[model samples]
Target: MTYWQMRLALLRHPISAALAAVNQSGLFVVAIMGTALPAVFFLILLNFGILLDATQPSPSRLPILLHLILLQLLLIGLMRDAILGSKARLLLISVPGHQADHKVSMLLATLVNPLLWPPLFILLSTSPTNWPLMGAQWLLPVLLLGIQWSGLFAPAPSLVYLSLIFLLSLLPLSQPMATWLLSEQGMITLLLMLLLCQKLPIRTLFNRLQRLLSHLPLPVSSYIAQSVIRQELHGLVLRLTLALMIVAAGHLVQTQVAQFSGEVQTLTVSLLAVIAASWQLPLNRFLSAKREFLLSLPQSKICRATLLGQPLLLGLLLFQFWLHHGEHCWLQIGLLIMQISLIQIVTIRAERQFVLASLISTCAAMVLFVTLAN
Candidate 1:
């Protein structure tokens, strides 16, 4: 097959192909909306930069910020094979190129996506004061790609190193170096990232998860059950990291919101819901297939079951506030719990358009609670 044919084969998975057939119009709408995100992001960032400059007239870090996000996306594409199902992995391996060449092709394909262009435009739209910084911005990808190339032999280490870079850069010690992500001083973080790219034991982590999961034999009564459990097991690291981030976000947002307003809370709750929804999606389908009676539950009963433990969530948030601020942050705690609970409830129960349900429910709940709080 030619290169483009090979890329096409890789992109068109069985599950997605079936879904496209089932809902072509919906899929087209989704594609259009997904493509529009870059435009939306570009306008938002461009205007924000303009507003900030109008207020204080400083050189913008906007380009560095965009490059950092692009770096993460590139790393995620590299990690895709590691996270995807065995079936997908097998199919990918069957594609007719050397692994390095295949990865290069995937990288090229990912960078060509229209969504990434907006950040460049956003940078360009900034004042000429940002031009010097923009020159440095182009080097960010080169540094990350260089680090990625150096770790072609150990994808796991490469990923772990990247994650560490992100985490450490958020720490106080790295703050001085964080200002310019592509300058010589900025290369400190990248150098530290490359140094940390020694072989990580990610395979061992997977092995341990498999051992524990196989001990109970994976609920293999059906394909859905088996696939759900396998994928869940494979996701232990990601799930754990997200959980930790959620916990930290819960505490950190009280401080962050003084600057960013409810956007931080909105994003935090949205993320918590997305993670919950992702887990619940396949599990709900598997259970509905297996028990069938779960489908027979009264709507009230289902709502009660899903919305259970609110008091606990509240208590935890209260404790999070005390842990971070040593006082009753009633407003913060209430807003977070309401937002998270509303989003999770919709995601768990709503059978169709999970994203829409979660967003509408969360937004409505947020508006209602904020109005009442005020």
Candidate 2:
């Protein structure tokens, strides 16, 4: 097929169509923000940079570079799903042409993408010192852009090979030799060379990764239940756990900073109560499902069973908390239990309305609490 024909085929694919829609909307917003905000920020940064430089040591530049590298790694990690999507591979393999022709065609197709140029501009603008390594730096963007385009059409076999190369690249090498080579020619050249070697290998690697994910012998319903419970409980448990741990660690800091005994006690008790309440949140869905199933049987009343389950779940949660933390703060715990029961009733009446109202109220309450607590 001709290059244009291959491009046309890519556009017709389902994944491409969905991605195009998302890209169109994203590009419009991004373009607007990119134009308006950067100018304002650059002017602010120019003034701030002078003041910051006067106060901060020159050695701070290393930390700034490290932060930039970490941020880039995070961004690249987030984009992995978009890179690995099935549509990407279809586009890569669709061109019935030579390797160089495929590479060039894919590169051209990528350049047409609105997402490609902005990052290239940002990379060039931010690290002008590295511009002396222009030949190597240019290759990084080109290779990345090409890889992104090819990944959409890369076969399953190619993905597997790519994964192996990625793993291999993580191994530690001779530090002095590596540093000498990287510093002399620049790290981008090394990155590009490594990427080029893995290009053909990725198709095989991806198939293995796909099979591994697909063949994992986990029940979907059980997994979903576990995930839901984890997500629901995470905010409460993680926050409370971390807060308590930090409080313990920073006891001396708190004392030195003027400790408020009443506030500390109240906040600690409130967090414990909140964590207790969170346990029943997942039980709402479980009880609701059970109620529905039981109502279909010969002798169960849905309303009675659901009402009974609420108290039973609440009691169980209270007992669990009591066992862990003891019965010292019963009043606040009782209030939390009542609040959770009420939430469950409201949730059953109209979940969407209840959830929206609860979220708004929770946010407002949190703001008020933080303001007052401080």
* Candidate that scores best on TM-score: 1
**What's the lDDT of the predicted structure labeled candidate 2?**
0.41
Over 1-374, each residue of candidate 1 has an lDDT whose tens digit, in order, gives: 75445555555564365345324312222222355767545544553344223232222333334324334434344334432323455555666663655465446544543334444555566688866655544444455455545444455666676566545434333333434443545555565656555544688887898788767753223334345556554343343334333434333444435655454554454444444444444455545564554445445345334324432343353234223322324554555455545544655577466567556655765665457645
Report lDDT (Cα) of residue 202, candidate 2.
54
lDDT of each: 0.46, 0.41
- The reply for model 2, stretches above 4 Å from the true place, is 1-109, 122-139, 155-186, 189-369
- Tell me the lDDT of model 1 at 370: 59
Question: Could you tell me every candidate's TM-score relative to the true structure?
Answer: 0.55, 0.34
What does candidate 2 score on TM?
Answer: 0.34
Top lDDT prediction, candidate number: 1
